[model samples]
Target chain A: MAEHTLVITPHKTPRSTNITKYFSLLLLTVLLIVVLFPLVVITLNSFKTEEEYFRNGPLSMPSTLSLDNVRAVWDRLDYTTKLKNSFMISLATALAGVTLSLLNAFALGIGRIKGRAFFLVFFVMAITLPHEMLAYPLYYMFKEVGLYDSRWSIVVIFAVLHSAFGTYLLASVFTAFPVELLEAAVIDGCNKLQLLVRIVIPINWPSLSVLFVFFFIWTWNEFFLPLIFLISNANQTVPLAVAMFQGQRGAAATFQSTAALLGTLPCLIFFIIFQRTLAKGIIAGSIK
Target chain B: MSYKRTRGYIGFLIPGVLAFLIIVIVPFAANIGISFTKWRGVGTPEWIGIDNYERAFDDTTFWASFQNNLQLVVAMTVIPTVLGLLLAVFLYDNITHHFGPRVASFFRAGFYIPQIMPMVVAAIVWRWIYQPDWGILNWMLNSVGLDQFSHNWLGQQDTALRAIMGMMIWFQLGYPLVIFMSALQRVDPQLYEAASIDGATWMQKVTRITVPLIRPEIYVVILTTAIHAMKTFAPVYSMTKGGPGKATVVASYFSYKNFFERPNVGYGATIATLLTGVIILLSVVFISVQTRQERLESQ
Candidate 1:
């Protein structure tokens, strides 16, 4: 069998082409294990008692499933508070950012504003400007304004950081839409604002909704700004809380892993559900 | 057809641009000024005329951090990208040849999950996996009779940055894989069939035909991933904290600590300015290369 026949283009062979097919299957399984291994490792540890975790090492399957670690971590990390903070900030930023960007897109992309090209270039350039570049100045300014700990500060910062992207996304959406329908609405006594609300939002809801979900996830996972702005445990988002935990006291394995697991679960579930759109936004960035 | 312009059009662009200006543009300008001043977070600045920049350039820690970032370019950008292309191509072959929708999407989703996983959570996961005694990696080595190989993966200086790089590769593979797969999905399959008719082998088809066609998408992946590698901070914040004595401290973390932790505001600002300039320069070069290639292709 090893000395066998010969090989040809994949089209000529049938599905029983054992070696290649098996190789492909094996390759995929390897990737699957690599990708999913972290989740499994954390989950397995989270279930085990600390002694069991130590005795069995990290490889052993949990002897018994338990939610004890998750429960303990929930209280320790103030999970609900951080989750609420994360949600509130993410929602506010998404709402404000998306709305502003939608308007900007409509103006420059559809309305043919005077500085359309300039705005487009400017916003696109923001994608390259790492947020770290302005981290300190914003830190000082927020401190001086005495607004650092307020939920509004995080919302405002995330919204502002992301609005340029929103503008760029929605600008493309606006530019590519059929102009006749928009013009028809304008001729039919709908004002610009009314036309945007009545026509564009409904027609482009699918495209626009992707922007919302993408923005929500981005703000939800945001770490650096919230780290600077929302200082207290009470005010910090989940990622910032986790970071402060690691920075201050990362030694506690049981608590930290549990907290990390619980915090990540929401985003994981959300992405699994909307993985297609997430991929689209990512691929959009790649091509752009 | 004539297009009518309305004042309301400008109305649409203002709110967003204003928010950006207030947040990003203003802070950016302020940082440039801040970089030149000899001030902490608060108080009157004594203009120090490039002293902070000079100090930053002289800082040994800054160079050490920069060394880690350069290492990341190979680990994070180059290796993962090469591996991702291979994964995409192989599965793409499976898709075009043997698999149906179920298999295709299953692999696609598996590849993408890591890309969307929050960085903090991912760092937590990997840190556990690299745990010294209790870590699965060391345990696996023991089971495989390679116990001599295992060490504290993210702890010591020699293996620490390298360990982080290994995980970084795993953490980053998804982006390029998904992007390339999407690119492959859009390719003209008839070209492959024609190549196959000409007796093109598997390697030939991939290298000679598929790669050249998907070159633009590949470049996009490289550029984006390169930027991500450069701007990384959360992973450092979570997994290592510049670690078991500064082995994994990349430039972003160096800037972050100087500003916030040490309160060296001016020096921190200088480091940040340098990083931003590098990012902008890289983006300009990448965009020009891409556009120039596009022009040549069009001709």
Candidate 2:
């Protein structure tokens, strides 16, 4: 990227440039606070009593960080079961969705089979097919099959829903693949599965990882599908629960922030840790 | 170049295609069929061809919701894009040269945290901030001697939709920021140096060079965010529940309400089918425009 720049900064800097630099820093600092302030509010308010929250008016540093609201919200919402269910459902969806896309991409992208273009268009069309159109029928369909109230049902639904994006992204990775790799694998008596398992997968792991992280986070945070598909309290994902509690309780419930913080905790932690990969993943997603 | 195609690829594709069929394609086709019928949430459907569609076309609620969707799209897409581009340009110029990569990235991440937060969580957070009695917005207004300007942000019909739109704009900032900043990084700096030599100021450079250079990224952000806004359901669903007299009803929420709230599955299917058509039309136009641009650029 630096190839574009002709180096000349060794000379004395202008006073105007120095002023602009400090001004930009100040602006960015304020903007950073604006972005972080809400989460900060949640974190601060979650520790305080309901009166303290109202009196503090969203700016009080928590008098002391207490586990009181955490324990309360945890018990009230059956947090343990819901978090476990969310992890299982989202993890399963991500695995199934990403794996499906990899094979689909291998077939349609690397193999260059006949009618691949048609399949490409077919999947692209699937991206725009909104869930509202299919939510009711799929609900009834699952009810008939006795899959209506299970987390696994959502796992299957999200897998298919998100694999469209996965296929779109992974296909790009496979399209630019060197033909020599495939030819060499075939000459070494490797079958198609071997070609994919050993060669294509290893080569495209970075793109696959990107797809996996995004699909996982997306599934974890999904609300509408969980609302439609999972009817029982035991099966609801975290977002569904937060939205339900906030709506039903009208933000008067002291633990609303507590629940919201708990619900967002996993993804927030993941973001703090793997944000670089997440950013790269999003960038990769857009380019394709 | 034998061009002899084996049928092996079909085996690899079976799992994905079958899942797509069961989950997406089957129900999708069933939705189209269902939209033409009169079915409640129950036993039998009476085939009433185009009746639901006709009802939707005449429905005031649907048009009102669609109008709200367009307004939200402008808020979510247009204003956000301009603001995000300005933020991106400022950080790209200032931090990259003056501070460092770490500072630039830290700023980017701060802007992105809300986007990464689940919309449900964000809704709850903003709901507290919009609390009519003790909410921060009203509190600040009172403090600033602008108490007359402050009302229940999410309560009144006049301000409910705009309040939700404001939150949408606030939370949807990071998408365009990342896209444009990333695109701008690729612009050859020699052009900037040459422009500067020709007596161009920073504003001129942005309008003349940076904007033109990152046109594709701008289009992508606009199209994607516009579609997102048009189809948005969560903010309204969580914060206002399309309440205060349906002031905040959006297309997605309208479709959702018909199916879930009213149990009008048939009509909901019709509305969803219509929304899908609009999205597809928009997407097709976007793709064609992008391709045309690409062709021109290559030329």
Candidate 3:
């Protein structure tokens, strides 16, 4: 490697160049603040009493860190129940979706399938279609089949609807694996199932973790389908609960703020735990 | 290589293909079929043969929403792609040390927080900040002597769509930035070394080397962003509800209103079909251009 050069040398820099870099950084900082400030405001406000909230500006820090707002929203929204429902639905979707997707990806990507390209393209096309277009049809279909209003129905819909895209992502990971290793395993009298469990699963833990975190976050954040399909507040996901809070109009701010604070917690926790894997998954998912 | 091996491959594809057919393909085809009918989703359907499409074409709300979507597509495609490419280049160039990429990646993840956050949460938070009377945004503006610029951002037609688009750009910048960074890393370091050896400057190295190698990704970004812009619903639904006299409406939101809110399933299906057709056309054009470029390079 060449020696690293740091120049404090008096070089003539163009005024425009200096202005552009400074401008870009300034703009970036402003954008970051804009994005993060509201979230911070919500969290801060959630700790303030209702009186404190009304008296002070939304941006102002709470005078005392009290959890009155949090307590009130939690009681009103039944936040723990909502959170449990959300977690159950999300976990079910992620687990089932990831497993099915891994199987599909393995078969299509590494099993020397004849029509792999056709299936891959079909999934891509499926992904491109507007999701809302399918909602009415799916609603009718599920109602006709008596699957409506069931948690399993929502879980199945979320999982299967997202399965193809997840498979498409996982297929890229499968494609990068060494084919010779699989062939050698097969030669050693390993069945297809055994080979997958022993060889592919062991080697692809990183990809699997990435997919898990991605699907978890996605299912946790999903709103539209859950809002339409899950009518009862008893079965409402966190996002749905939050959205329903908005339906009350003027009184919605405090409730909505509380909901926002509650809804973002799980995702923030997940991000903190699996930040690197989450980044990898996002980059991988986007490219394909 | 044998017939048995072929059977194995067929067996492997069966479950996935069947699931996809039932969940995705059937619903898609059903949506298309519904577009040609006069059903309110409860009654038996009557064949209306392009009436819904005609109504969609004539509906001023639909057109306005389509226009908003077009604006979004244009803004998102250009602004995010350009800004993301610039950020990718900056990170790649400035952060050449061991810890540079890691720090940049951390920032990239930070930027993605909006993307990962539920749209409901994002919209609620933004709505709070954009609240005209009691908003933090107005407070900050007044403090900075720019109070005149403050408005009910999501409640005003003039600034609602733009404000929402700004939110989208902030939320979406991370995905493309990360993709571009990966594509940038794939660029052979030797080329940059050779460019420097030939007395080419940093700008020249980027324009000639980095940009060309990442054209495919750029195309993908444009295609995805455009399609996503057209189909945006969650933010609109959560933030403005197509409000300030439907100024923030998009095609997908219109479809949603027809389907769920109004129960005009046929009309919603019509809008959806049109949206899908547009998306398919864009994708075809993009794929064809990419293929043509590849063929030219081969020759």
DockQ of each: 0.63, 0.57, 0.47
Give lDDT tens digits, candidate 1, residues A177-253.
78788777767878888888988889888777777888899989877777777777788888776665541143366
Q: What is the lDDT of residue B63 in candidate 2?
A: 90
DockQ of 2: 0.57
Instruction: Give Cα-based local distance difference scores for all models.
Output: 0.80, 0.83, 0.78
Predicted model with the maximum DockQ: 1
How far residue A263's Cα lies from its native spot in candidate 1, in Å, is 2.6
Off by over 4 Å in 2: A1-13, A246-253, B1-7
Cα error, candidate 2, residue B121 (Å) = 1.5
Q: Cα deviation in Å at residue A61, candidate 2?
A: 1.8
Comparing 1 and 3 by lDDT, which wins?
1
Top-scoring candidate (lDDT)? 2
B1-299 in candidate 2: lDDT tens per residue?
Answer: 32223447778888888888888888999999989988887989889999998998898888988899899988889999998988887778768778987888788878987888787778878887787877777877887899898888898999998888878877889888988889888888788789989999888988899888898888888888887887788888988888788688887888888888888888888998998889889999988988998899899
Best by TM-score: 2
Cα error, candidate 2, residue B291 (Å): 2.4
Cα lDDT tens digits, model 3, B87-127, are 77776765443235666666666666777678767777677
Ranking by TM-score: 2, 1, 3
Q: What TM-score does model 1 achieve against the real structure?
A: 0.93
List the candidates ranked by DockQ, beginning with the highest.
1, 2, 3
